[model samples]
Target: MACNKSFSSNYFLLTPEEVGFFDLIHILFSTTKFEEGIKFLDMSKFVSKPLSELGSGIEVALNLIPSNRNVFVFMLNFLRGRAVKPDKTSATFLSFIGLIDKRVELDGSIKHGDANYHAALSAMASKASYENSACIETIVKNHWKMKFLGFYDFWNDYQGKATTQAFLLRDKTCDQDTIVVAFRGTEPFDADAWCTDFDFSWYELYGAGKIHGGFMKALGLHKNDGWPKEEVKQDGKPPRPRAYYAIRDMLNKLLRQNDESRYIVTGHSFGGALAILFPAILAMHDEAWLLERLQGVYTFGQPRVGDEKFGEFMEKQLKEHRVPYFRIVYGNDMVPRLPFDDNALMYKHFGTCLYYNRHYEVKVVEEEPYRNYFSSLGAIPKMINAFWELIRSFTISYAKGPGYKEGWLLRIFRIIGLVIPGAPAHSTQDYVNATRLGSSDVFVPPKDI
Candidate 1:
């Protein structure tokens, strides 16, 4: 496959730029760019939350999703629903998937370049899952308790409030003291966009261009004055405009007040990619070359970073130490599982890899990834959605709302949810007029971008 003119099969697939990743030095030092490098560093890609004029545009998802059940189902469905690209080595196991002729009906359009969109509409609907499920299972299969920390929940802290990132010390009896922090993606669900604790302008220094004026204003740092406005480069080219200092600051904060001890990194989807870079920045800071002390790195839904050579070098570096710094994807999940080989998306030079972690496993949670694709469509038919979607003003809103009940009602509602179908109980929305949610609004996902 190396330097072969014949691509494995697909053409657009070969675009090196398409293979975005987090396994680098500034981006992949294994401790800085990706905080989860040490353990399961679950981040909702915290720092990447869109800082828009209208605020973080999280409402697009809200308007589409009417109830709690739908939201919950959507999250669960999409979490493990990435289509797998067929490979020569493991094609035999695919064995005419039992669910092959069964495709889910879509009430709307599948995202172009979006696998979930393809899975819901394409013939291979039942085959997709998160690329990292098996890898995540292996790392925690033997654990006494698995703690799930939603990366979005850190919004308060990110907004300058407080966080549970270092809450591990609270649990004295917990074994190994390993934690997994999870974050949400842009599709289907809009993760929380509370920019509280961190310096707004500093975070923007990491972003491209003058998009973040509020951030600039907050830090008394201007885009032209301090931050460099450079087009985001996906190749091996370094991000020069944005300084890694913001990321470096977060790392310093994470390990600052605590007695750093046993830790590892883990994340799902985007968080998985961030895991590599978070640690990398930290490694650079450690005068002692602390990167070598890492126990392992296990991320599900991990994406490729940089060119193949970079991925190789990361693998080689980690493998030499018997550490599990490998990106593990399930056989079926199609989140662009890169060639973990030397010519990989990240760590291209050298990497030690074990194809499948024994403990890694996939539990087919759903017969179909999005069974209720029809219901979510509301009135839109699958075929006609193309034109209608454009006409409709795509609105997204996220907020704290009243519950169905305060006492017995909450319990009754919970019970009814089991008996009858439901939507999301918890939700967030955007107010078109205001940059904040309701009157106490602070931030929102960008309307554009």
Candidate 2:
């Protein structure tokens, strides 16, 4: 299947200013002091202008900083006494920060806007699933109606010792017992995450080539071994991703212990890719009981995982089991269209895509349009088209500023493949906004079923 061409609903939309405000908040929480943090915010131009006008200033600043430096430090050094210059806007912003700080101290979560506005905005918090201590802390304290149960960190030995992280969360206020598996996405500023993000080499898996080798290794599958001999034809099947064995073992124990609990898997970006593959692996191995207990799989800005055959396999299994796989796409999120949509590359996306248009309208479609192969030209057209779309989207959203649109600036940046650290549409908070609004009417299967 190819990309969806339409949206399903128009529920809520986050304004450019509001996007800037949240971006500012993320920046503030990630800094050491109000002054220091505000300095970066000022540099990003995210402090005074809408993010659409200035682009993601936070991402640009993050690109310049060292990767080892912790990006999300929650401590706020409130500037008091005569040294402080109090202005109305700064005062109001500080007051807002103070409120968030209070909420963090009190309940570990801060509400984004008014509760009655929309569920999406209401459910957003500063929480993210990064490797940073502060990010983990915020997630532990926040994350709607869920309590942190445990964290699983896996190392990809095959892929230059890369690390992947996931969280196991349980419902804090459970009407029916539920366990949530959340995965962390690529960190725009972090070198490790960048490495993972760019490691797009394909490996053969389940009779298909072009599966991301790095991701396969990260999932705990090895080169020598293949999927369980009983499951697939052993001729040349690649091993399961390396890290998944430990994860599967853990989930096995959990499922055995709580037979009645429903499991929901979720992630953003790269993590979203993992979330999609996790269940597919389980189902492929004929783990029927585990598949039955799976309530739903939700992903935000997930890239295409495998070829058309892989997608077909996944869709069939998921549909037969009645599992609702929601692939949430935000406005012009380049990641979803990535690893290049070339037919030769053999990459295809699975599940129902719920795309949020430029207006943040929700469009639901079964699959994206398939790009047909054209002789030796292969997927070049598709690749170029996807890349151009990304460039166009990025340009419209971020390159409209004074110096950004200049001829030399555009040409140089294009030649160097310079990218703004984070895509605004792909931000975790943006996903939260979309999901909260879209999931209001979603049905949650019973635990006993």
Candidate 3:
């Protein structure tokens, strides 16, 4: 689990493949040979027994999910494939890509300066990112009336495969053409993508603070070489094109061609993590030119990405650059309230948190209520809320019109949420609904900061 020292002098790395059940149990009794499963550059500064036990237990439980997910997805697809045409696009465990809403057109009435317009557009783009290239291209060009720049599957050095996915599109308005980059989130059955969420390995940079190792890797963190200012090329081409370098180059060319054009970064769930992290890297590399043109960043159900120090660094950078970051959390969506903001993993979220309830009422808070999902006091209320959400699934269209209708696939997930409340709340449908139905006043920046 040893990483390149030049990037992070202090790091706690985990190689799940190297872990055994007995080794995990041993962590509860003793610290000896813990390095056999977990790697540390220098953990002695504050390595506690509770932290070790918690880390081991977390790895074991979360690892089971991805292992079981693979089989479940295979069985699901196999059964569905018999009755219908084989899905060419990425399909989640419960939902078919084709069956979900394909509407990409924005609201004709909602204009610029209103956050609803951009939020709705970005949410749709985020959902589109989950589909295949042809599907994404079709929606962007034919439905949204926008230009589809490109779609990519970028290389992740840790996964030893292209694990990250994103797309670029250009929207021409009356005043200026805006470039949008949408990063895809974790798919229900994609084990590799889920691993990115579950893997809690961390790296502590000199001034930037500790960051999630999985995300950095997904965002083109090279194996031996860290975030080099320039894209590293092998022979004539990159060994495999990485996301940060490739997108940075694309933006540089696209932005220069139109001086009036500015760009925005956006995503949902795991994609949201990448969305915010992308700007952090730009600031880290001192890419003032790119930062100046960065209009905003919008994320839905994004997880906590870094330690408090990292949060401070990003807040300062964003404030200095005058870039607004809106982190939208819908209802009890559990993704926004993790990896537990505790001593074991010191991750903390920064910036405006636009938290929405079942009615799509937004509350702008520094942090979402119940900062951790595993709260005993919030359990009963969350379940009651989940019950209401399930009922609303049948009645929302009637209340909010046909456009707000919930699909059968999503309804099934809502039923599952009765037992596990926040799981279903994390869907893109609710986030989209929140943008359209919720108040735009939540987008107004607070002066106190």
Candidate 4:
């Protein structure tokens, strides 16, 4: 109930339709109907449709049945009977919407919070699919994969985590000093939802912490496939202490396995919030080991998870280990700017914020030389990031190349802009100005007077 005070019902994982459909489909296709469903998919006239179009169609179909979400998933299972490569279809779809980059652009019509990168998998749209053909193929494939896999119901292994047998992946090669962890965020149904497909075993969060041994009722902290929420906070702050211990024990076990590696923490969206907090929490619990071994943090689109007091405390905590930390934001993804009130100004302005927005911003610094320098300075790093994104986009840019939508450089820049911690093109300047996370510079705390 208290947690409800922080994240309203709107914030909970499921909408009424989603909840109904998920449970409903779980029942519908638990048997042969699943196979019949697949047979039905073959009914589509365009079996040979471009993979991207196939995926896009699925997406539109699923979205159309907003209330009957299960039908979309059932259709996927049904289609799989025809031996469609559901995972690849899903991966392609994921790549389309720019998930690989750690963010997904929510269409303006959907209106509200940006879709968490964890939700649907999509690839960049194919060139033909955009102008000449419907995006149905690309969207459908991803939706089918998600539905068949029961991704919408990610906490399928709560019993295992609670029973102390949760699914987790780890590596002993890491320095005992440099333990690394990546929070799986809200969803760990599978990898490849994002373009990175970050190493599962080494990353800790994805393969290691994911306790998805079976079906679950959804009440656990997501880092591992455990109980969603076991302890409630008496104080209105993010559950940092609880999460810290959960992480600390894991690192200790990892270090106990091999004594050489240090620690690094990272994640995307809410997971990113945990990544930043893990070290802070560890430092509080075991300062000696944590501080000495702490390497850095890199989170994308992390939400502000605390009250002003807790936020300030975390600010100092992270600063101590700030050198290696880098928070990447992408393209005005709104999920990153959540759960923060105006009580804390610095953080309100800078901390727990997204680097990008629909309309990019230009800010001026006091006694600072550059006019809108953050935006100006930010442009270069984004361009650099875009270069790599071009490679990824090449797989799916369905738009005509050489135009704004089609140009390799421009399209990929938008893709890169989605995942980097700071918004592409401007927010890196904000990072530059940030004393705690950016390059070290002597900072006099702003006078509260």
Please, what is the whole-model Cα lDDT of each candidate in the order they appear?
0.27, 0.50, 0.80, 0.33
- Tens digits of per-residue lDDT for model 3, 16-94: 5454545433432342422313832222123434454554454334333233455576457557763222334422211
Lowest-scoring 10 consecutive residues by lDDT in candidate 3?
90-99
Q: Which candidate gets the maximum lDDT versus the true structure?
A: 3
Cα RMSD to native, each candidate?
Answer: 22.0, 16.7, 8.3, 17.9
- Each candidate's number of clashing pairs is 105, 18, 0, 74
TM of each candidate vs. truth:
0.32, 0.58, 0.84, 0.38
Superior by TM-score: candidate 1 or candidate 4: 4
The sequence of per-residue lDDT tens digits that candidate 4 reaches over residues 157-271 is 2112221111122222222223335444433221212111111011112111211111112113433322332334435855433334455555666666555655555555545
Clashing pairs in 3: none
Looking at candidate 2, the ten consecutive residues that score lowest on lDDT are 5-14
Better of 2 and 3 by TM-score: 3
Instruction: Give candidate 1 regions above 4 Å deviation.
Output: 1-175, 179-260, 283-293, 319-322, 338-449
Model 3 regions more than 4 Å off: 1-3, 20-84, 87-103, 234-237, 445-449
Better of 1 and 3 by TM-score: 3
- Candidate 1 lDDT (Cα, 0 to 1): 0.27
Predicted structure 2, TM vs. truth: 0.58
What TM-score does prediction 3 earn? 0.84
